[model samples]
Target: MKRSYLLIALIILSACSDSADDSNREIDTVILNDLIQHSTEFEKKVYSFENGLHIAVGYGIANSIMVEGVDGNIIIDASDSVAEAEEVYSYFSTINSNPIKAIIYTHNHGDHTFGAAYYYNLEVEKPMVIAHESTSQYVERIMGILNPIISKRSTRMFGTDLPSEQVINVGIGPYLGVAQSPIGYIKPTLTFADELKINISGVEIELYHAPGETNDQLFVWLPNQKALMPGDNIYRTFPNLYTIRGTPHRDVKSWVKSLDQMRALKPEYLLPSHTKPLTGDAVMETLTIYRDAIQYVHDQTIRLMNEGYTADEISHLIELPTEVSNSPFVREFYGTIRWSVKSIFNGYLGWFDGNVSNLDPLPSEEYARRLVTLSGSEEKLFLALEEAVQEKDMQWALQLSDSLLALNYKIDSTNKLRQEAIQYIGGRSLNPNKRNYFLSSANELNRNYEAQPLLPQTSELLREISIDMFFEILSVRLNPKKAKGITQRVCFLFDSGETRTITMRNQIAEISSTNKNCDIQVKTSEQTLKESLAGVRNPVLSVASGEIDTGGQRTKFLSFLSNFTE
Candidate 1:
């Protein structure tokens, strides 16, 4: 009789396993089908429009457009890398072999600006690089203070490290190609504050500073061609009001206003930095629905916030209306409604959710300890995690693993379980951003997983960055532990007639233009200093050769620099 009972229990367990597998398979089928259909939007080809304008789609994460002219052509938004840009230009050359007279950047995003060097170097005179007045400073910030964290998050968000089979698409494009070659960013020569109307290659182009997706975002209007190039503001996928890769709060109101500005022009051609271009009647229809979707989310979120709903609660409550949701342009391929709601909330009210309990919550580890006790014991908590996974309650299993991780109990086992849970959910996710982030997080849990290094910064790229920005970079990188109890002032005299000083006190590096009472003085050209700091040139050799002249003990100056090293 005991043998019969044991056999029955084993049979029941097997049946449950089969049921879960069937359910997962169904979810996977739907997700895979949707992603495959969406991938068609980025089919590699150059889309030629009326009036000598052609856009090369799927060459990289962003579209590179060429406007043919009488003597030369105008290039808008360079691809992602020199390699991708070269490939794109090869195709453009076939259509029109005219020299690239100018290159215009829609924003400061690497995908739009990094490939400009390829086009810039093609001409003897060099194409005039154009952008918003604030573009260069924004680019410096990304490459300077925020480089480390942004690079890591962007790598995961795009699934750049994932095997090809695991990645379907990056929503806006096929894949991110920034790592395929050296970053080829060139500083803009012509920058505008509000608007600039110029004739490039006999093409009457109008550029307006439209801040939406990025603070430096701009829209290009070709009055003669009846074409409007809305950089990243309007794409095929849902607008990333807040990207998972991390970004400053995207101003939703500004985004709506920008779209309305585009609609007012009533252009016949609509070309975006990412995805395919639209023409004729589709232009106004897409712009209207896209703007409506953004406004709806923003207004509804505000309404709920006023009703005392927390961000978490508001996220669950808000949903896109049927008309907006049905439109192909606003599908959650790049961004989702829930994440947007939370971001909108945080943007207005900051981190505090007006909840008393959340105002001063227990530390994570402490909370984990109490939760583990509530579960009877650490061992019981581990069992609960296992049971959650066994029951296919992946989200619960992931939460349980968090407690085990905080306690430092069975870390390897807990991570493995957490990895399995995330991978399962990721495999069935329709949104590529969420899917990639989840899978990338799972990959990170593996003991053998290696993170990719930051993109290589070439000497050419370093020349474009300003010396003042380098000092800002140094200030942020100052090691507080190493700087503790030390006070010193170091002054630098650059060949460009700029004097900057760094004063270290209270474990912080303060920067100023004052050059008086310097503890150590260094004299170097801006380029030489930039190269030395970037490791493109050897500092020891530079100092020994007098390229960098330290007015005092070399060892003392070198030691002071070491305090800023990570």
Candidate 2:
């Protein structure tokens, strides 16, 4: 009777403690909204540059700049979101009643293009939307490719999940807002081939292809007026490299070259995509510093690669000198140099360290499970994990939990860990992208504990990725030495008889092959294919596991596969 009473008392105490904890956990909804609110609440400045030439800055969501050319008035890169765009329209109405002749989007990034719709949604017929040809090739494909990934990263960077907070700012100024992108965005209608010179209100705004932030970047240069628009390409901050919202690695070389191109333009005053509008010879100097800062990342990465430094080592070892890292223009607002350096290394050298020990690696979860076995007893392992968590070593805590959950069933320690880890990581404010993953993982683990669902398998995870992320996954499959000659040709075929072929040449994965009679046939609907490539699994994996005939054309197809360092 005594032992039973003791057990009952313990259960009651646990319940009481949980209730007390829940009561104290305030939502702070007001603060969350305020974070979203003040994030982009800054002064919008209107400056008259030259004769009838003027530009508007300080827009929430996306940067708004009005160019009063000779033809009429042209708006370049309308703000990203809806409410922000309308405010811009209101700002323009206050300035002048001049009809908008055209709206040119510098690139395909949602921010620069989406704002075009708001004015059209109003009484005005939508001004012709302009962009580079590459941007318009297939708007659906690009969105299908990047919408989830970029928005996810952007959401994390901007703290789109929660309301928003001062600590979670993604831009330098208080102007850039944070939030998830709505489902639909305005697609560019008109596009340029290479370069085009159009007179917007007699203001000669030369639209040239300067692929900086995105592949289809359009830079507007007022040659006669000595003014320029670099869009998101030449932000006042360090170029966002390896954004937390996931995408393929950006080419640091191309990025730097674009900045150099901007520097050569020698514009007196410039309105970039983010931060404040910069003017004077000081603008050029700032641009130069920004250019050299990116170059530092690229050059150091290559040098380390030549010396055969591993990606992890390169990420930790490479650092921008004080001249670059600490520069006002190089602050990590959108992206960090550390992640960028890692990206450069990952882009060139691939993931492997050329070591045989890491050649045939088990999946992360499976490896974690085995580790728990090696360490012995659940209680002892839990103690180590608690210590790591207490020390604020989130990295180690996460790694330890990986195997802990992998190893045991119905362990109280795992449940405690799930609850504690979530609280711990949820409190820390790191990079938006990293925070999301950490928090999401905590959520996932919590849900798993609440229900004790079976852990996911590596194969289950890989087969569900999309075309964009498949390259990253494929890179991981290669050994360092075999990675040298592994170029690949991926031809995506849709039932509509339309086909898109991607040729990944040079650098890592130097070999190539297509799905037409290649190794590893992936026969599925376009959506399924997309889901798989995006690193988000599709239902087809279940069918594959259940021995279902879901594997259509590519079920048993095999492509020539090899690894190479280009």
Candidate 3:
């Protein structure tokens, strides 16, 4: 309890250092090739091609997937990073003189797109960029929201924040012992909306925009050669019902449909966006198993929801049937079925535990303040939090501490104890999203402790995001039932005459606005959206910043939104 009071004092003096520095880190080019940065496959490059004109630049262990038949010699998902790009470039230099024709980006995901940017300089025409229309949007969205969080979370999860040697694999991902800088989000020069067919060096490539795990996704097919690369679709484990990084619910129906499409192909060679390549009849058999894994999760979760099961209950009760789990192709690496179930449930229905008592329930601090009168000391609250943390009780601790801190900012140990306790849990956590939250919470707390009084410009820069973002967050905080039928639409006008639209539906907020709106509506500002999406901006102050012009109805729109999850 004494420590708790002490942390409060420290937070008041140190809240200023909460700014996070997340600029793009430079890619190391020297040891790019020889270093495959050991993934699950963990093997050296394997090259084999049709007529020796094309080559399979293998990664992860087996040449899981290949970028063959570029006009002359270009890697599909060129060498893992910039460094890898250099080595792959060096190796190809010995074979082909076609100036590496072009990179056919299967999708918008960073793994497929980032490294290829290095190849543009080696060519004259800057290898014609191509992707699904949403691929461009997906790249923007991830770089905008997912990547930064994942990068920071990765640092903590992999102990990049701690000494590198001490970090051990929790057995989830392959990169368990590397401290690295964040990668840049490479923008695509060429984009496609739906279906596109291109002839690169006689390789008939077909790109279809299939919204499965990612909105901007593609599946390429070569009919003459009987080859198919299912970008991320067939790449990750299982059917990938959901992602660990918090995003919208992926369409399990669409995902299943895509696999069904793949099953129809029965191609001789199957290339995934990640992992190893699989061939022959087992490929078809394995894909069906993969398809079933996702289908079952989506179908069962829907079944449970229809049966009146809440999100948490469905998450706890749901499981892949015996048939799906028994298959080797249906493994849980980056994307887990449990989360896929949650994402599906969340998209269809907002989050509600199904208890009426939880409907507009009092904040933890409200209850805690009342408890203080009964318990008569800060020591009791301290003991309660201590018990919660010790019991591995995250939700309870978040609720209790939130209320406690809201009630008293004078406590000294709040930041330190919270950081220590949360870091301990986050370090050992298996779930990426849950682990990231704890780590971020600790980061915030540590920032409060490290700063002498208040956060500075960099931290405040994080504070300038849109209100629509807050409403989305509020939806996450509210009961799904309450979130039902809730819809908000607003336009914000920036001083620069730029406008952004904030729309929240299905518990997810999509913030985008066009400069050509009839009212010249400012959907959002560049800085504000960044701050809000990055968890840096304060929503209330964002409204007060005259940088936005909603025209006439913006205020009433704001009021309606303010009560969203409250």
Clash pairs (backbone) in predicted model 1: none
Model 2: lDDT equals 0.58
Give, for candidate 2, the lowest lDDT window spanning 10 residues. Answer: 451-460
Off by over 4 Å in 1: 1-23, 538-541
- What TM-score would candidate 1 get against the native? 0.95
lDDT of every model, 2 decimals: 0.88, 0.58, 0.54
Report how far residue 348 has shifted in candidate 1, in Å. Answer: 1.2
Query: What is the per-residue lDDT of model 3 for residues 196-224, given as tens digits with 9 covering 90 to 100?
Result: 88787666777777778677777877777
Structural similarity to truth (TM-score) of each candidate: 0.95, 0.68, 0.64
Question: How well is each residue in 265-306 modelled by candidate 1, as lDDT tens digits?
Answer: 999999899999999999999999999999999999999999
Q: Where does candidate 3 have its weakest 10-residue lDDT segment?
A: 24-33
Whose TM-score is higher: candidate 1's or candidate 3's?
1
lDDT of 2 by residue, 167-280 (tens): 334453332332223322455666778898876567777888886667777788888867778887777556876665665667778877877887788888787766667788
User: Model 3, 45: alpha-carbon shift in Å?
Assistant: 3.7
Query: How does candidate 3 score on lDDT?
Result: 0.54
